[model samples]
Target: MKTLLIWCLPALAWAQAPAANPPGPWSGGLGVGNGLEAHATRQTGGHLLLLGRARYAWWGPKSGPGSKLFDQLNTRSRQTELAVLAGRSLPVGRCRAYAAAGLAYLLGRQLGDYRYTTRSSGLLWGDATYYYAYRRYQALGLPLEIGFQGPLGRNQQRLGLALQANFNPERSAYCVLLTLNLSSWGNRIK
Candidate 1:
């Protein structure tokens, strides 16, 4: 019985051992559905990272027909945010899932054009003219994100798919992004 128990222990240990290390810093991919997402992260420690990203979308409401109106009115209907994130990875099977929260700067604008009438009839129609105004609002936002990351190439590069939610005083927006970690650029750091 002792011999059988010892043999089983080695098998159990092998089964419970951690998976191999994921490819390093640079990793990203392309696909169809929403859009593309890319990111770069600098590791500060074993479980900490500083991240930044630039994203673009071509099918969203903010980028469609209404965009022309916003351009004409000198208002911005799109979004560009800069953020810093920190999170830790929890191993799940062969992959790692992470949850991160951070702060971001939200920048965008809105425009409207309307006419006001003093009377309901055509008599006052001449008195009303085109009224145009541009509104611009900028605020700091809180961003919360969760996603999974894993190895893609033979090197240290990794690919990540994540969902990011931005909370602002006025409104909130959600984005799905695919990120690539540029491990090559990261290795230059001493």
Candidate 2:
């Protein structure tokens, strides 16, 4: 009985172990999706990013006049991102799933009210003030995504959906995107 058990254990382990390098060619794709996201920036009302504060704070351009004295404060900002990635794909039932990680860049801007009073030529210059809601920021981050795709029509193109996250030193952002991919996968999974 002991001899039989030992032989079967080795066989089971070998069959269940995964390969070091799976069989597939490296594939790439481009996707775009919108989700509730947040970013880190050097502006007022940009900190204390706990809870759900990050999603609602930075979005769209601020409204109102850009004057020092009668200026209106803006509590919102906007962010735009682009990423490039490469990875492999595996078949899951009738669909193919892939995971990729690479670099991403973000552009952000905000508007705010500013008031200043200074001395000019040794005289009180209370009117020496100017304001414009202008703040722009840029950041680089690592982005990872996992998604599933299937054939699109008769061509080698595929349409899929994915969930992605961007990791950086400042903050982490997430999204859910619809993806379109064209790769070397061919008709292997059909």
Candidate 3:
């Protein structure tokens, strides 16, 4: 019985041990593929995160038939998003797979180009001006993200890839992002 017990002890000890590398609590990501999403996230407890995000995208000018060559259609946008999220991480092979969902507040600002035509001293002058045409609105959104991460240099920092979707009554956007995660369980989760 002593010999059998000694053999089982090693296996039980390994089972009780944590993995060599674990996902951290702090994650910052910059997404750029078709569009851009810049976000920072910090874990509050074991499975909850608080996030602040900002995004900017250039949609380009709008064109149509019956429009002159000089006719301008300017559209651009900037946005800010805040969220409180909950998530769980599962061990997959040597890495961790995570999924999170949250409620978000989005502030969107739409920019447009203004065209001004001026006549000075009976001389006709055509001028085009590029300025911020402000159209700001706020909406509530649902944000979802799924991804996998692995430790880079110890369990303090990790590198991961994620796919995200942000949806609201006004618009819906998605992103494929690369993330750098730093563990915040010890110091500040900022």
lDDT per residue, candidate 3, 48-91, as tens digits?
45365555443434532213434433434555666666676776
TM-score of each: 0.57, 0.44, 0.57
Task: Answer with 2 or 3, whichever has the higher TM-score.
Answer: 3
RMSD of 1: 13.9
Candidate 2, residues 12-107, lDDT tens digits: the string is 554334433322232334555554433211111211111111221133323343333333234345555566655555666646676666677766
Give lDDT per model, in order: 0.55, 0.50, 0.61
Q: Give me the runs in candidate 1 sitting further than 4 Å from their true place.
A: 1-38, 44-46, 56-76, 111-134, 186-190
Candidate 1 lDDT, 20-97, residue by residue in tens: 453344333332224345556654334646476544423223443234433333223345566777777677655567
Rank order by lDDT, top first? 3, 1, 2
Error of 2 at 63 (Å): 14
Q: What lDDT is obtained when candidate 2 is compared to the true structure?
A: 0.50
What TM value does model 2 have?
Answer: 0.44
